[model samples]
Target: MTVKAEPFDLSGKVAMVTGAAGGLGQCFAKTLSAAGASVVLCSRDRDRPELVRLANDLAGAERLAMDVVSHASVEQAFEVLDEKGIQVDILVNNAGVAISGRAQALSDADWNAVVDTNLRGAWTVSQQLAKRLIEQSRPGSIVNIASILGLQPSKGTAPYAVSKAGLIQMTRALALEWARFNIRVNALSPGYIETDINREFLQSDTAAAHIKRIPTRRVGVAEDLAGPILLLASAAGEHMTGSNLVVDGGHSCASL
Candidate 1:
């Protein structure tokens, strides 16, 4: 007897991705759209022509203005979606910032900015989505974008590391709590991926030295994360929750 494999189809599902203007968020938006999900690409400023162009290129794509750092902005975005009857079945909490400073020199504002956007903003979005899903009696999936630094800290990234660590814990807590509702929450932790934002840094001597230590001996690209993101966002991972999938090119293992 032969058995058929489960389909990873996300057809007819609606996906909302925060920070979809560029970088990993852009890659994520494209990936989700290619998988047949109606994607809502969100950014702080939706007026950017590039965003509009990207949205036009993807099937069932729409752009929206959303600032995860502000509660009002989050609520407004959701309201717009509600008005349009766009129910979000999958959420990619990919909006985050990194502030580089020595631990002792890190200002309160810098710390708060990173924490508020990465940790607090994620919570705000997740809470809102959870409420809506529960009210509608629907099962949903949430994939939090975390970092390898969250598991193993490095120098000059105190604020970023702390925020991502908190996010990892948040993923587990929400996953455990929301499982009762058939809602799945998981974290996707990526290592140093070469994106437009970090390309210059990755070319520097400091980054080169770091790359040599990795078992893969190469840096990752934005597209490298696409498949993993799709897996967690689609039915392929229905039985998975409270799990942290680390795609770090074995960098974390090098320490051992």
Candidate 2:
């Protein structure tokens, strides 16, 4: 008799992903769901039709309306899970916003918006997951979507860069504090993904010039992130935590 061995499959696992309506979020959701995990797509635009299509395509995937900046909203969102007896085995804090401007020209509102969503949002969602995982005696994984900007500064993106830097530190702190609960936390800092966010900019000569600096000589696609996202969320990365994985095509390394 042969005993069947399991691989990195996430069957029976439940995943909650923030920012599920966007390109990156949709990629992660589709990848994880394809790998056999029940995915919960959370975003402020839960009513959007695109989300409905995503939910239908991915087995066991669903959508929830969530605003990460509001603590009261977070609590209320979690209450639904509590009622359903759903415990998340994986959490991806993939929601973020970017604001670009010279340091002096950046408006206070823009700065606040970037920080509140990129940094505070990740922290708040992680807190919500940590509390539930600890109380329910569940072991889980958390992958926070940071940026290469977090590791180094990019010109004219002070607010966006600063928030990502903060997220890396927050992921480290959470990993240390929650290790006892068997919860792993880490960050993925992707570089120059060709998504809705930068499509127009990349089409211009100036933007194309900057993109050519990458060793790959091409911008990343949304699907380029799917494999890395799954590796961190599934059993394949069970031993890794508090580490920031940089997926930039060497753009951050070039001097010129």
Candidate 3:
């Protein structure tokens, strides 16, 4: 008798990525799709033409309107998935917002918005998806997009920093609790990536000066993180759980 060896083929795996209209989330969705996972591209607004177009191009991908901060929206989106017969094998909690200001100057709205979207949103999505995975008795993976600010911090972005720190701890706690069910939870912390949300900052002289401090001496591109994103979403990271994979050009080590 001969034994055939199978490889890291995610042929039947399904992935749900929040914030799919943004650069980082879009990269995750496309990368998972390229690796053979049927992907669910989700955003708060269902009318994003670019996201819809890209999802259509991905052959096995679909789109959903998910407001992670709203339990009703999240429930409706998952119900859509169920109706479509989609079983999510991976969930990427990448929906986030950044509000940068001195803590003393920050308004209630600014603080609430950041905390609601970045921290609570990830928790809601993870809890909902984990429940589904547990019910099905299926193994799953979850990757939450955190930030280096979670480990270190800057003075102005208190809410964003605190939210990310909470996200990292959430990943660890969830991983510990869900390990028995074969559901792995982890965080991907990217440092100084050039994306639409930060385009103006990236082009500013201050951002340029900051990039020079990095050991890599350059800013990170969206595609640079795509490979790591794919690895975690696929069987390549099957044994990895509760880890924070920092893909930041070594900036966390360099001091001002």
Best by lDDT: 1
The lDDT of each candidate is: 0.91, 0.88, 0.88
Question: Taking the candidates one at a time, how many backbone clashes does each contain?
Answer: 0, 0, 0
- Model 2 earns a TM-score of 0.95
Clashing pairs in model 3, backbone N/Cα/C closer than 3 A: none
The local distance difference test score of model 2 is 0.88
Candidate 3 per-residue lDDT over residues 100-169, each given as its tens digit: 8889999999999999999999999888899999999999999999998898886678999999999999
Instruction: List where candidate 3 sits over 4 angstroms from the true fold.
Output: 1-7
Give the Cα error of residue 25 in candidate 2, in Å.
Answer: 0.4
Best by TM-score: 1
Worst 10 residues of 2 by lDDT: 1-10
TM-score head-to-head 1 vs 2, winner: 1
Better of 1 and 3 by TM-score: 1
User: Tens digit of lDDT per residue, candidate 1, span 143-223?
Assistant: 999999889888888899899999999999999999999899999999999876577778888888899998999888889
What are the RMSD figures for all models against the true structure?
1.6, 2.2, 2.2
